[model samples]
Target: MAAFLGMRGTGDWTDSDMRPKNWRQGVLWQYPNGDAPLTAMLSMMSEKKVDDAQYYWWTQGIPAQGGTVATLNDTTALADDFTTGAVAGQTIYAKVALAVAKHFRPGHQAMLRDASDYGVDTRGLVTAVVHNGASSYVAVKLIEDENTGTGTNLTDCDNILVTGSMNAEGAAMPSAIAYD
Candidate 1:
């Protein structure tokens, strides 16, 4: 038998101290926290190579507010929409990260949407995460095609990104889950 120590910052995978002796030695997966606004926020910085809000649009995260737990440790159903408060007219969805305990079904497409329920044009990859203080599972809608292209639908998403760390930090893992 082998020992697999679980740590944080494995880059969307279970942090394990031991190496995988075989194909299934350890379980590593991506956990969603929320649709991070970093992309949109950075786009505003004139110093950086930024793009339009549409390129940073992502529909995958919990609402910044109003996440109440009905029971102790019960899986909470959560959702979030973009706002102009922080990033001008552009808005980004919040979501939790995927986890090792679960596997994101491959080849899934999420229809991206906005507050108006209209499909908008976007570019680049969306970084999702698991929000703070939640169970392993999150709400996700699988996509039939990966052809998100330059303008994927916002209404649909594969998974709602949630907080990454299992700890109380409630943010992405500061360091690699398991560094060499």
Candidate 2:
């Protein structure tokens, strides 16, 4: 499938939590390929963005096709043609740290600031949440608008930030404020 991107946790392996481990290895995150006809293996690995470095290691040999998990046993890039002829069905795999972007929660809104050289502040409901291993991140759909009237107040937990305003009941940022 072209333009299809997916990531899953490898908790059953040596790096169970998916946390950045020892020195250089932390820069590598495993992506297992599930059952799907390969069409964009070459394009995927080249698309990984890591801060100012696009030189993130890409395995010349992609995992046997299925999905990201194909490289679970071996994270090395293979010399197999996973996008061309008979070997094109091989799995795709790669890894990188999550420090690549400003993280926000799904269905939540935030007054954001540009952490790097990127597009305008993207604000909208956190749409989809993807769990990598130890942490999870959400995808945001931009909602072009501004708040004018009273707004909902929020609190934080485990680093999930909430608005600094008070609740409707005049209560301060409270964890009891249910997440919408």
Candidate 3:
């Protein structure tokens, strides 16, 4: 399993701006209290790069605030069409409704799961969107973290949720926020 890399510290518990002096790339700094969930406000900052380019971050929680964009087609065979019978490092082409094709764009983070059981789920980064008149697909490169099932089980991926996105390096900030 992959580990979350960062510093764990103790403080006065009142400083809202508390953070580690050294911030490593790909490390999500989470401060947890003994036997309880985080009770303090959390803030994060990225160190300035040598080139000074700017990057933006956005996040959406589960039971997505927006309406459903699409769901994995029930008829497709998961092993042959979606994943390589494993959870991570495979590029899965998830079939979705053509009507919602416009919402699955590259660079988006997609979270998929069975509606009845949330534990059977996976999250991946959208690498491509193929739109056909009758059928459409979202090609997602699976992120190696936080997957719960084999990911090849068709019944385990009945819902699709786009949680977040990351633009290309040096890309300008988006002018607006749109949710589907």
Candidate 4:
């Protein structure tokens, strides 16, 4: 009774083998092509690194232009804010607005915005199938406590769906993603 094998190939959770070979968008989470049930996109459960984008900035991911949301992250965004580009580091699909799905318990620290998967954003640990481009989309490595000394600051048109940080196997599973 323990042989699920879902993502089809399991290679980076499928979806055409994940991606990120040369696209730009540091954070991403799309899962839902077939079965669904994989959540989590950034680490969280007790480490308390829950940040939100309300006043921080950085952007640049224009292969076809679908990675907008820039104010300073770098790449000079402003083409009506990208819409769906492709290669520079791979993986860029934004449009979020979440408010549920919380089971964090691996490292404690989660978030999602403008990562419109529809289901209200943020599911469980979508597991990590990722990377970034030369600071890919300009620095997006905020781990914890920033500006207010507690962690979380991704302001300026929030955009998330980066499900890439899952390794749960002992209790708290439902992944993560709990915003409001």
Candidate 5:
């Protein structure tokens, strides 16, 4: 998978100086592994100049070989697991098995949920990651609470699914993939 910053223009010439000033900038992704390319314009650079761009890329599923959900090492009651609760704007840490730690990258979106109950889930953005011997501790900033009640006592939640990622203009390009 790879992403590129691009612009659209009319009557464009081979010379870079001839590029249109009104041209809009956008981001494009190519999934070489077997998926259609995805594209979205930057809100600040949109034609209408509206700040409404909401772009995200779905994360690849857990490797079929041997990957499992992340486990919660602490509880919210003791201020250990999910330190500041599971509400929006809170950063929480979870223990991810090393086999799948590579999927949790900074700026990536993650989904936390109770494996037994799919209805209870929390959405967050990955902010930091630390790989320790056999597992990794991923720090995610809560963005939305799907159905978590009062966001209390969430020790039963043992799954951190890397759903997708949201990107904004000016952010650094993905380093894991080559860029054009």
Candidate 6:
């Protein structure tokens, strides 16, 4: 079997939807040889990017695989990768805090932006989010050159509560709301 990556959510354990309490202790990946393999996970602990212990494990112990296995948990990085056109299999897991919806504007062509940096912008085929007055919604879209001009507006939900790692198919962004 191929080596599969293991992930354990490290969030508020007291919360009703909290995941595992320990992310690394029980987190593991089965390898051909029982030899313990290094692991890495990423998240935005605060305003800054947060990478799990695996980052140090790989950087210091084993070399990272060639693929861009990005844990999209970082909002800023997610936008950046998507803007540059994320690879077909580039892994990304993130937490979205707003309404996750799909958008398809016939004549309106927009691109994903780096919302993490607050002001930095990105240009991609998909529109990550659509700003509305004082609120924002996670506006995701599929803009594959091969799938364009299909004339179908693809949207799913109006919002998403705290959830686990999200795998972006086309262009998706994690929306944030201020609690002032």
Highest lDDT: give the candidate number.
5
Better of 1 and 2 by TM-score: 2
Tell me the deviation in Å of residue 42 in model 6.
Answer: 20
lDDT by residue for model 3 (73-160), tens: 3233423434324456666666776645566677788876677776666778878777784467777677854344544454356666
Error of 3 at 60 (Å): 17
Model 5 misplaced regions, further than 4 Å? 1-70, 73-79, 82-85, 149-153, 177-180
Estimate, for each residue in 27-60, the C-alpha lDDT of model 6 and write its tens digit.
3322313344342242213334346554432224
User: Ten residues in a row with the worst lDDT in model 1?
Assistant: 65-74
Clashes (candidate 2): 21
* Candidate 5 per-residue lDDT over residues 46-84, each given as its tens digit: 455436566444455534321355555443222354433
Query: Candidate 6, clashing residue pairs?
Result: 39-54, 40-54, 72-93, 94-166, 99-159
Clashes of each: 61, 21, 0, 45, 0, 5
TM-scores of the models, in the order given:
0.20, 0.22, 0.48, 0.18, 0.52, 0.18
Q: Which stretches of candidate 6 lie over 4 Å from their true place?
A: 1-36, 39-97, 101-125, 131-142, 145-180
Question: Roughly what TM-score does model 4 have, to 2 decimal places?
Answer: 0.18
The candidate, 1 or 3, that scores higher on lDDT is: 3
In candidate 3, position 177 carries an lDDT of: 32
Better-scoring candidate (lDDT), 3 or 6: 3
Residue range 1-180, candidate 2, lDDT tens digits: 222245333233354564533323333323334322132223224343456543454435422211111211111232331221111122222111233112323334432222231232223443444546423243333344322222211110012222332224554543322212
lDDT of 1 at 53: 38
lDDT of 2: 0.29
lDDT for model 1: 0.29
Off by over 4 Å in 1: 1-91, 97-131, 135-152, 160-174
**Superior candidate under lDDT, 4 versus 5:** 5
